[model samples]
Target: MGYIDLEYAHTCHVKSVSDVYSLGVLKLEVLIEKRAFSQAEEEMNRDLASFALPIIEAGNIEETLDRRPVPEPTPWQLHALKHVAQIARCSVKFAGKDRPTISEIIANPETACE
Candidate 1:
């Protein structure tokens, strides 16, 4: 659930849109290759979502992704990663209504599987 859900979350108030937040968190986990909030690291910015948001906002999402064994990402991979990051960034909107509905997400060019 998102901030809105957290604010008024109960069995009755839960809605399908709440899953949008879970999807966002899943996206970030895939991109970061780490737990959403782990004690494995000692740092002020331990939340992957928070850590990745600014870079995504500034169009530097590539910098936030896990380093690869390959020398560099291929053009297709990089493009795909960018799209995935954008979806992840969009998924985590503070308000549930602000997040994309499942249909919108599935149909979105950036998020839809190519």
Candidate 2:
């Protein structure tokens, strides 16, 4: 998977945390409507996490979001999107230990949107 956790390079072993991280990348891909890696004019833009994480952490996740919704997102929808983005942010941390458990990632978004 293009979304494989970066820490896999050193360990060459798969861990549950890596699954969490990849799920997070999937979440971001859904939100941003971009693949983990793709053809783009800028090299950095080729990777969704590299391109969007800093923007997300910088508090501008909306900038990375897909904007094709017909009427634009409602406030509630925007809130949910932001919450999911936060989960994605937590999922893609460089260190596996720094990433949230799969359960936390799963629960947080459901609770957050409530």
Candidate 3:
């Protein structure tokens, strides 16, 4: 659950989309095994999603991923991770206008990402 839900900001007023955004953030949290906000001193308590978006946007997915690798995951796992990150990136748009609707979010992993 994110403290910064879309409802809190009037600029974007889509409830289902907001929920998708939260899910995206949760995906990152679960994948990276870190809090939503990073406590690492250098990061200055930045939100993990915020910290990761640039990395993902830069096409550096591995850097934003959990540091502890699991004996080299399969290619499909890596692809799925990248796809989930893309979904997360779309979900956490600063403006709701840019975020995907819940329906799109639901379909992306199975169709769009594939």
RMSD values, in order shown: 4.2, 3.0, 3.1
- Across 43-104, the per-residue lDDT of candidate 2 in tens digits comes to 64467788788888798877667887734788889888888898888888778888888776
Clashing pairs in 3: none
Q: Name model 2 segments beyond 4 Å from true.
A: 39-41, 108-114
**Order the candidates by lDDT, highest first — what do you get?**
2, 3, 1
Tell me the tens digit of each residue's lDDT in model 3 across 10-90: 554556567766777897786667787767788787886777778888988866577576746578988878888888887
Clashing pairs for model 1 are none
Instruction: Please provide TM-scores, in order, for all candidate models, with all chains considered together.
Output: 0.75, 0.83, 0.76
lDDT of 1 by residue, 26-110 (tens): 8888776767765554754366666678888899877767775444678898888888887777777656666677888887756
Worst 10 residues of 2 by lDDT: 105-114
User: By descending TM-score, how would the candidates be arranged?
Assistant: 2, 3, 1
Top TM-score prediction, candidate number:
2
- Off-target runs (Cα >4 Å) in candidate 3 are 1-3, 10-14, 67-69, 108-114
